[model samples]
Target: MPNVIEALQPTLEGAAMRAVFALPQPLRRLIAGPPIRIDDQELALDAQLLLKLQKLTGQTGLSAETAAKARAGMARATKITAGSPVPGVVVAERSIPTDDGDLPARLYRPREVTETGPLLVFYHGGGWVIGDLDSHDDLCRFLAKHAGIRVLSVDYRLAPEYPFPAALDDALAAYHYAVDNAADLGSSSDAIAVGGDSAGGNLAAAVALRTTRAGEQKPVFQLLLYPAVDATRRRRSRELFGNGFLLTDHDMTWFMEQYSPQESTLADPRLSVLLADDHSDLPTAYVVTCGFDPLRDEGEAYAKALSDAGVPVVARRFPDLIHGFANIRPVGHRFEEALFEIVGTVRAALELHKG
Candidate 1:
């Protein structure tokens, strides 16, 4: 088995392009953060990769500092199609009521909007601290356009202020509101699904469990992008890939600290669905993992648990990808291929539920 660093090197092709074979780890860390060694591949730490991220940031014609600042206030990520635009599938902004206040959300509909297209509720990744709709905008638009589905990007409250059940509550509320108001949004109430990347994915899974417990129909399927399903921070993967990846043990600890008001909530099943008593009644799932991420093992573990409990679960590990590669769709061929594969998976999953 290779180390985490080895697993992540390839994903840095553009950055490491034409580089020497034996550069020191520290230099790489300064340039690209850390990589987790798993089997033969290496995974880059998400934050560092994004910070050192070159092409997408440049192509978007936005400075990293400026883009990061704008992201602080937004909710869901998004992008629009060009050339022969769809008549009605404009990316629009709106808010849904939560117990505390209005939770911001983005709606993406394609042209020829069916009075009831399947809807996907999306959450952005930021370790519960940094991301917003602006960060993930491109991916959501791609999914909506490619899958012929409606995508609602949720901007739930972040940590250090809202914390824990606050975000969870917001996610649940947004979901129900979307379902109840599906017609107004021009989507089928019965076709709603929930999903997110990293922390958002964890929230989506928890929402699915809570919704089922409350006797609501589970979302059609969960589309989890390398979700952080366990908060314990004790898994071997955590220890192994903990330091070098863009998400280090320190960073995750920071995120957990910010997101959980009480330290004990780290063990709460709502925060760590992998610790839940049963995953049997949850919706079908498509869980994606990165070979080099610290959360890789736990994501796979949750998928296995779901499968073992008789829930239909499909898992994919992108051996050559890093944690936030899903957000960098326009950068590399690998991202484009992965993006299409993701949409195809959702399309297939939704079709099954429809039948």
Candidate 2:
């Protein structure tokens, strides 16, 4: 016999999330309290409410749980918030063969597009620990439908078990597989893009650098959403917006330790992409950051370095949004609005190429 309150905890939680958006915008704003100002930017009403709700839940950090528990909690959270998969997009489960074994993947496309075109090789964000293909399924579907291109969402190995370089190795392998089997995957080998959010974005940036330095075929574009580009930097954003935000500085530290146990590797360009001496020769990039994110400074720094290196880059920071907003659509108008603008930019940059 479960306690009645405990039995209804999930139901109550889900209802609370819905109730926030169910209210009139004015009332929601009122409950969200005053605008949270930091670094000359105002936090959006929706962000404040979500953070409040998060506080009520008392979920301070995933580091408190084992990696397995953290993953389970993340999956449950996604189920509560991510909503349904967008329709009219076909999804096919794929097994991308890697040196270690077969890597799981999901290929997404508009149901109408049967012919070959450009494709985005995507990675999911979980600080190299929690996220998986299922957690990011709606995100992939949203991108495929809205961006009007194919997306291959790869499930790379997680850390604390398969640590540094394993995920990157799997990422490189998936990209090469897409290139080698472009026809089968319905993508133009020369028009492929590499993209992801957070840790996934880190992998994408690393893949681009690794490929270019090796003189191999590289992605034509990079979609980096609030990426952890500098692992070693102690920036101001971390001090200001580190706690109370969706992602905490302590969480980042714990995640990095689990992923890259070697303190020596923190300075490696592959891990700390901002440490790369030259940002030249990298693919065209769209770097997105939010004013309230712990990774904001590093992401912006990477974008500036890229632009200074003469690479064509579109860097935009949504003044009011928080980190991980890209995948938190279906929760509120603000989240959906921000993601809409982002995919619009992605569509413009990685437009489908008929080849």
Candidate 3:
């Protein structure tokens, strides 16, 4: 990882001062002792959670070497506590058809649809090996309420059981299902958008590309937040931000080890969207990144490549945020701002799709 000094540079003197300054006191000590974030006392709670997990699993402790498969299984369930429900939005459990079987899905819709809006198919982030619909429940609700659109959250099967193509297959299946069943789901917009964080973002991009190739309708927009788009693990971000960050090199390597194809699928562009031959026909996109995140550079590179390919791209780098920050709005105020930004982007994309 970049030395502590370099990584903290952007936020050291400015907006990120809080998260940065706390590093020495709360962050640094936590590495060898215990994690404590001055900005949020709850971080101490996370350290405790790690300690508990470590003890239960019979592992040494919560360190960079924790096994990802165990982590995924341990994180099987994610609960989202609502601050308050948006007046018109309702979150309901549902099913989406896929080639393998009927996959689980959650549908979120604004309370009222005065007119047609946009349909968003969202995937959750958990490095492909972890995460689920429940894990990202808050994000879906916030998007539906704030963006004023119908959001279909897909619960694609994870890796080591389903593996790489399995999640990718489910993602495409869910998108097509949303397209075909939009009316039944009370979706007003004909144009569909797909989004997700981390691994989910990878699936979203893959679905878009696959849809285009299959002659299926493309999503009107793509929203990728700190997406793990490259499976090859050759990027500078992979090397530079490999350690100390919330997401460490070992954790990523473990995730990749669990989710990757058995043989030579690593080179497949579908697996690594960054290596795709062309980004030309893809939908307009909003790529979000956390300044301290290891995946930051590749995401920025993808945005630039998309722009270069003639696709309209909007990139937002939150210097004060960390990876997976969007999943914890209750923990940090920045989460709320990020939610609003996502809503704005979705609304604008829907409007453009209409025109």
Q: For this target, which candidate reaches the highest TM-score against the unseen true structure?
A: 2
- Candidate 3 Cα lDDT to native: 0.72
Alpha-carbon error at 222 in model 1, in Å?
1.0
Q: Pick the candidate with the highest lDDT.
A: 2
The collision pairs in model 2 are none
Q: State every prediction's TM-score relative to the real structure.
A: 0.79, 0.95, 0.78
Could you give candidate 1's per-residue lDDT for residues 1-355 as a string of tens digits?
4676554434444344324212454764666645545678754333334445433333221112333442432221222111123244569898998769998889997765656778999987877777777677777878888888889999899876778888889888989998899888877778899999998999899899899877986687889999998887577777766654456676677677778858788889988998989888789999999876788899999999999999999999887666666776654455668779988999999988899
Give me the runs in candidate 2 sitting further than 4 Å from their true place: 1-12, 352-355
Judge candidate 3 at residue 315 and give its lDDT: 92
Alpha-carbon lDDT, every model: 0.74, 0.88, 0.72
What clash count goes with each model? 24, 0, 2
Question: If both were scored by TM-score, which would come out higher, candidate 2 or candidate 3?
Answer: 2
User: Model 3: what TM-score?
Assistant: 0.78
Sorting all predicted structures by lDDT, with the top scorer first, yields 2, 1, 3
Query: For residues 1-355, could you state the per-residue lDDT of candidate 2 as single tens digits?
Result: 4788765666568777988878998888787887789889999888888887777787665454678888877876776675657999999999999889999999999999888778999999999988999888888999999888899999999999999989999999999999999999997689889999999999999999899888999999999999998888889898988888889888898899889989999999998999998889899999999999989999999999999999899999998989888666878788889888988988887663231
